[model samples]
Target: MNRSERRACRRLRVAGAGVAALLALSACSSSDSDSSAQLDSPASASAPDKLSGITVFAAASLKETFTTLGEQFEKEHPDTKVTFSFGGSDALAASITGGAPADVFASASPKTMKVVTDGGAAYGAPATFARNELEIATLPDNPDKIASLKDLTKSDLKVVLCDRAAPCGSATEKALDTARLKLTPASYEEDAKTALTKVVLKEADAAVVYKTDVKAAGDKVEGVDFPESAVAISGYPIALLKKSQNTVAAEAFIALVQSPAGQKILSRAGFLKP
Candidate 1:
């Protein structure tokens, strides 16, 4: 099915599922089974009663889906509130390690999560939650007649890329290297959203960004599939921070994201199964 069809079908299914067990899902790198099968309720079986709140630091690519997850989390645990800080996963990891007030960390790449895991900022080994791949996002129409990774090398094409420092940028580099192609970008964006925004805003002709970002952008952008994307897939990982004040609520939130409900929501957003 296409995007609209999938979204419509999900709405009908959610309408019937009720509010107490709200969540979403998407694709990624986990070897674990869908956790939602056993933890479908608003609160996990081990969740505490009347918890105050939980704060999550996640990748910018996860903003849309995680927002949905946050809302569903609040509904499931009415006593709890979910607040999020979304940006480049690497930056978010930096903030977490710098003593940012956050309960959980969800990163777009394992390399960024390593910044925390290596620093012993995380409570334990982070679990691979999902995976994402890069796609060429361009203006709604094929104005540039852009086709493959090689097409991006056109000197006349104004290409935007995520900075090599970010996960999306790193993935873009991998894809480019796989194709044995390199083209200078007009500008290097700080994050995937900004890179995509350039295409939507008509400031750039094309951008290499996360597939999920293009999916979230909807009609604002058009996505081009290329073979090299499979070679540079990004893995998403999530874990509780050592400074967590409410581990019960925090754990419940991560559990919900890893649950089937979370997976379905994420799948709708174009994220790959773990």
Candidate 2:
């Protein structure tokens, strides 16, 4: 009876130990499975980028260079797009202050940018990215032998000037004041591009515009640098709008504009660095 009882007790103990070991293994397996699932969860993975696209309102004088930069930005981002509205800086500022849906604003003058900032449309302080100076765009050649700013005052010559509200026009007026000359334009274009177009199309013999505009026109018009232009230089400022739908993308574009590559593009287009 003693031997059989002892062996039976040992068998019971062995069976119970086996069951405990099996339960322990199952608990370890369950824990490891839970850990693996958590490691692969969406929360643990890297977050996706929030950048998509943005709309930019810029000065007409920046059309060419900004267009080039916009294309480059799209290419680099792949998932992003850049849309631009180029016009008079004052008009653009007015549009922004009027609640236009834009992600960014690049004004030809700090005064225009102030319009946006003062209206609470700007996200932060506008940064000056480049500068521009006045230039006289002639009809391909000096047909009237025009050499200086005063020569544009000839009554026989038809000259165009940007409207007084525009940055280009303001700069032109400053130049004229510096020269102490009083000359009326044949027409007042709303923007520098339009004023330059007048001469490019021969509608006017000459136009007072930004050097960048004259350069962007290529050989369509000849550029004349006057000493008074130095006093009439305008600074180009860029800022993110307060109503921007894509803040991340807008900031990135601003960074690109202030970057070395963007400055190089601006320089190629005859813009002065800030």
Q: What's the TM for model 1?
A: 0.81
| Tens digits of lDDT, candidate 1, 93-196 | 88888888788999999999999999878877899879999999989977888889999999899999998989999999999998999789999998999999
Show where candidate 1 strays beyond 4 Å. Answer: 1-51
Estimate candidate 2's RMSD in Å.
Answer: 11.4
Native-to-model Cα distance after best TM-score fit, residue 104 in candidate 2, in Å? 0.5
The whole-model lDDT of each prediction reads 0.88, 0.90
CA lDDT of 4 in candidate 1? 100
Tens-place lDDT per residue, model 2, 75-137, is 998898899999999999988889899989999999999999999887668999999888889
